[model samples]
Target chain A: MALDYALLVLAAPASGHSSLTAVRFARALLARGHSLQRVFFLDNGTLTGLAAAVTPQDEHSPLQQWAQLAEEHQTELILCISSALKRGLLDSTEATRHERPGATVHPAFELGGLGLLVEAAQTADRLVTFG
Target chain B: MTAAARKSILVVSRHAHPGSSLPRSALDTALAAAAFDQPVALLFQGEGVLQLLSEQDSRAAGVRNLRKVLDSLPLYEIETLHVDAAAAAAFGLDRDALPAGAEWLDAAGIRALLARHDHVLGF
Candidate 1:
């Protein structure tokens, strides 16, 4: 049986090939019958949580891809609050707190503390980082 | 603890000094894990070993003084620090050149150590 595991995807959506590599790896894991406990986004990876980001017309949007994957797998997509705030990737709660005009965080991702990342690293059967 | 119940966390540091500030992220994560009394071990390889150098002037880099952050590890009960021997040599450093607390491990040692950890997170 495939081991149930967790993955920490740490690449920004627009950050060259590593971003696509992470997405492809996620799909491969599922196809091999593994499941992710959560997909933790940190540092520039938090940019993937932005709902307003627009990819090139000719390119696929990893943000949309991530949302679709999370929906299909029922995986928790967590973006680190500190990293997100620094990069201006704000969810509704954060947008309201910062008095921003509109919430920028995609609904598929949730804003959380880095502690969640720690928890995932400590408890998950496997934690792989991308970036 | 049973095979499934034991908690082991590996924190990987891959960034170098004065160029990127990933050590701060690694240290912060270590502190957070240590706060929970988790058995967290740090593995420094590649440029990440630069973080272990005893002498560094973050003032020149105008960074957040990650050296000070690393010095606080033991206070939080996080003491396991590992450095890849090859990585250290590649950076022109030996175990003695690193800070007093870090332990050196070879490539095979690194692989074995990683196998012991339940989860691994690279910063």
Candidate 2:
């Protein structure tokens, strides 16, 4: 039977190479005909969804890339709501909570809690983390 | 058995190398498990403590600093965060340097904690 996988991206953008590696791995998993149930962004990895920041010309922005992949593949992009909120990452709900002017969450992303993590582990055939 | 009674997971991360991808990956797994309502614990060992160090700037490299994600742990309902006391001291890290509410544990404590978990992932 084909395997269903969950890819966890945890490296901070500048701290390490996990984001890029994860993207590659996700692509590979898809190419192999495996199903990607979700991409869970945690800790520094959550920054992968912030599209507002200006990236340099030379650098590869994992956030933008992941967002595009998630959109194209219909992969679930989940940003830990607690982590996102504390870091000033507001979804529509959060923008209203702090009376922010607008939502910081991108289109391909959703704010979620820990329960999503559990579901990924229980439901997927393999839980692959890129840390 | 009920889903809630399933095995707990332990993730041990010891590196926070500049531009390394493991930290974010580890965090992703932890958050995903927590989001799924699975029991998960994150343990910081060795150089991994640097991940919690405050005021990191990834702008020079055109990246978002990851400290923001660490700040979001409680929001994900992933409250069982831990750091090795000896490792923290060896790295000259103090409580203030980490996110608020992170627990400090010694090697023995961490080992005991690991024993209780059903799975352990080291990065």
Reference-based TM-score of each model: 0.89, 0.61
The digit string of per-residue lDDT tens for model 2 on B1-123 reads: 376557677888887845666676578667777766678889999889888888788888775577788888889887767999888888888677788868899878988998887666666
Q: What DockQ, on C-alphas, does every prediction get?
A: 0.51, 0.21
lDDT of each: 0.80, 0.77
DockQ of model 1 vs. true complex:
0.51
Note the clash tally of each candidate: 0, 37
Deviation in Å, model 2, residue A91 alpha carbon: 1.4
TM-score of candidate 1's chain B against its reference? 0.88
lDDT of 1: 0.80
For candidate 2, the per-residue lDDT at B102 reads 83
Which tens-of-lDDT digit does each residue in A65-128 have in candidate 1?
Answer: 8898899999899998888898898877788899988788889999988778777765666678
Model 2: residues >4 Å from true position, as ranges? A14-16, B1-8, B13-44, B47-123
Put down candidate 1 lDDT per residue, B3-120, tens digits, no spaces.
4565877889999865774666667677777776677889999989888877778787667666677777778776767889898988888566665578889989999998997777
True-structure lDDT of candidate 2: 0.77
